[model samples]
Target: MTNAVTFKILEDIARDLSSDEITFPTFLDITFQVRSALKDPNLSVEQLAKLVGAEPLMSAKIIRMSNSVALNPSGREIADVKSAIVRVGMEAVRTVSFAVAMEQLLKSKQMQPFENLSQRLWEHTSHVAALCRVLARKLAKINGDEAMFSGLVHDLGVFYLMSRAANFPELVNDKAELHALLVGWHDNIGHALLSALGSPESVLEAVRDHETDREISTVSNLSDVLYVANKIANRSSCWRDPELDGAVDTSVLDTLFDAETLAEIIDESEEEVQSLKAALGG
Candidate 1:
């Protein structure tokens, strides 16, 4: 794609977002429904289970997630959606809904042309999400589940941009142009798309700032946890190619945890990270 075409696409996307006309694929219907239902404070576990049951695949995935070692350290198991919802809590259910939706979106026919990129994106997302959960609990003393959810949705803008880019064969065929476009616009586009999806302000903030490098004495908040997790994941990120994109700067990590402590944290949490990734369909 030429400079003119790229600029035109960016301009069009900006106008659409400013007007609150963000486009989402049809597969997101279930996610929207689940999120809308989750907003009802009075909704009981049974009610939510009934709604989840309407989608058999998602219900099964939730059950599997509830049974995953990351969520269920106990050897106990749950067989049904209601029990799964009770075990994982509503926030986790929301995360699962998005996980399922993203997996489905990646497998869709329209996205087949970019299958490799989509798979890499999902792998990066899963790695960051699991790291966020572990770092939040072990270092930040915050809600690990919430941190994981934030990590999972942090790259939502990239997904949205890819979905739109599929319509332009010229742009889609040029990897360099496509990568540059996604890098330049994903953060703001993700924030807008999350806002349109009625995401929480805290989550929106984390998504918006995950890529910004900053000095930190501690991983104290959700944003801090996400930012650190993203940096760690970038070591094995889909967006990074050492030969092409150059080496990643990991100096800030030293300020957060000494070499040994950080290594220990990652080593101890390796199993949990892989378990959570599997649970989320990585």
Candidate 2:
């Protein structure tokens, strides 16, 4: 509709976020609980198993991930929860837990009306996450897993907006209309939601700043990696929207890594990217 009307809708979305009126999928609660609990330095494998075991689906996913080709290149498969946790490491478990939680979130009954849109977003997110990991590892020498995690949740705002928009079908019934709202506000709204959810500082900054065309900080960080990875991922996939291409700042490639090097890196990581995407069920 009108710009004023759109602004009002965005304001309502912000209010819902602050008021905790917007609901996340049920599995996220368990994911958060386990995530927080895992942060305890004194937590033992037995205690970790006990905590994760409470949720059968989470436990199963953890085991499955532990056996994935990325982490467990060895042929030995992990059968027990304790072994799975040890095999995957706490950091990986935390990341995969959220991935599984997101899968549940996407499958929620509320998402049925926007299933096609949700799936597209999820696929884009998965690609971004894979590319982020590769970029972090090869270019920035950062923690690839953590970068991947950041990439996975970078678009939290888009999902939040869609779920809330489900409350007002008139605003989102048309695909073009909903996309316009997402393009306008997803970054700001994502920043707010991630802050509320206690996301890491690196991830929060990356997600909030990735879309902007700006100079690099004194030193390279995850944000730079995210911006580059997001562009590369979009280019490699069909998700790149022509209308939004000009919004990206290509200069980051020169400051960070040359386009040729970046493309080669992405090309080399094709197998790894596909494997990681399948692991995340992208």
lDDT values of the candidates? 0.85, 0.74
**Global lDDT for candidate 1?**
0.85
Q: After superposition, how far is residue 242 of candidate 2 from its true place, in Å?
A: 4.6
| Top TM-score model | 1
Structural similarity to truth (TM-score) of each candidate: 0.94, 0.84
Regions of model 1 farther than 4 Å from truth: 20-23, 242-244
Which ranges in model 2 have alpha carbons more than 4 Å from their true place? 1-9, 19-27, 215-219, 238-260
**Number of clashes recorded per candidate:** 0, 0
Give the TM-score (vs. native) of candidate 1: 0.94
Candidate 2 per-residue C-alpha lDDT over 1-282 given as tens digits, one digit per residue, 9 for 90 to 100: 544556777887666677856554464676678777876899888898888888777787778767766667776888888898887777766777777777777799877887877787778888888778877877689998888888888887787777767766666566666677887788988888777767888889999987887766422579988887776666545343455433444566566566796668778878777777877763
